[model samples]
Target: MKVLVIGATGYAGHRIATALRRRGHDVTGLTRDLAGAGARALAAAEIRPVAGELADPAGYREHLWDADVVVHTAMDYADPAGSDRALIAELVAAPRHLVYTTGISLHGRVDTPELDEESPSSPDNPLHFRYQLERELIASGLPHTIVRPAFLYGHDSRTSQLGRWFAAPRFVGDKDKRWSFVHVDDLAEAYVRIVERADAPLGDIFVIGEENPPPALEVFTAAFRAAGHAGEVTVHPISPEEWLEQAADQDERVNSAKARRELGWTPRHAGPIAGMATYYAAWQAANA
Candidate 1:
């Protein structure tokens, strides 16, 4: 299968593109810079890199139309909703097997002990725009699968915030706030399975994460020790108003049984606590 991965130079997109290539698919990654470090890394991995932008579909329309599957992992942090809305509109016109990346943050503060694909989006979810995007994609009648990955970690993922936390270990808002996590390599495998079974059905949602989640304090402390930092992690308290505005104060433990049972996707890495040392080392190498 020929696959086109947008934002292929990104943290998750790069890994997903390489995994598809390793699975014997013809994979091309759309990157902003062909001569940048990320594009060079893609070339080193034997994946072709093409220059393009998500905000401008015409620049990458040919690549989009040429692929058997189009995986969108690029997101504009400054205007995430706007960027996704435009991309989805373009995708709706040229339908293909699409794998869209969403995040557990969309679920917001879950009242339940464990959130899953079926969980309802919290009313106060700050990223409600993402839910709107998901609805738009589903209603577009496109054959697409939505993947909501838990907090992504490992392999130099800045999303984990471990690198900064290692330098100054601290917890914002709630120390006991639990969050689910998935290794980047393991998340890439989930994408591989989803793409391989593209013919199955549309509108399937997968929450990709490890089985159990740990509190923020524990996870951070373990990472600090793993990075050879010997000190107590500071706890920063914030008002409920402040926390609610951020929409990240509540626990976000997730269940990935759906991905495991349906996509036959099993996460290979142990949780973040178990692989802290290896992950810290990878982050250092990438930053170096």
Candidate 2:
């Protein structure tokens, strides 16, 4: 299948593009600037890049004929609803299916409690905006798949939540900070399987996660250990909203059972501690 990964330059979309291409599909990456990071990342991965803004329907529609599936990993952080409303019509009309990426943050905060697709979601956090986008798209009657992934962790300096701690051990109070997680590569592969599976049901929301998501404190401690700064680690007064700050109150657990049962997605990275160690090593190598 010819796949178009909108926001192909991003952490998730870029990986998805490469994964599909490696699997022998013709993959195209759509990014804001052909000369920008997304384009460069796609080019580096050998996925064809199309320079276009997702908000402008006409900007990408010309190439729509070439895409059998369109995966939207672009999050319009500002005005996500308007962006969704603008593109939903065009996106649904073109592709056989559209894959929308949402995150476990939508489920709000949970401390090791198992939550699935049927669980209720909290709309009071930052994800409230994207939740609106998800609703609008699902109601469009388009053959669409919603992929809700846990916190994404990887070597990418921009996304690795471990980066700040690894650079230097800092004191964060309490271990209450917790979050569900999925390795970036694993999350990307889940998207690929969702598209490849012919029987994947439309309007199905798949939460992609692993068997265990480490507590926020453990993840930070692991990062410090990986960086040889574990000795300096200290905990004092960690904010309840440790990652996203006070306004972004979230501590959540989400399971990817649906993705595993239907799409056959088996995430390779199991333990967050070990994953953070590996991610730290990769970050050091890339930054070196």
Candidate 1 lDDT tens digits, 65-121? 899899998888778777777777777788888899988878787668888888878
- What TM-score would candidate 2 get against the native? 0.87
Best by TM-score: 1
As for candidate 2, its clashing pairs are 9-38, 109-251, 110-251, 110-252, 173-236, 173-237, 173-238
- How would you encode candidate 2's per-residue C-alpha lDDT over 24-136 as one tens digit per residue? 89899987788876687788887999878777767778776578888888877666667667777886666458888877676554334676777665656655666667788
Candidate 1: list runs displaced more than 4 Å: 238-245
- TM-score list, all predictions: 0.93, 0.87
Candidate 1, number of clashes: 0
State the weakest 10-residue window (summed lDDT) of model 1. Answer: 238-247
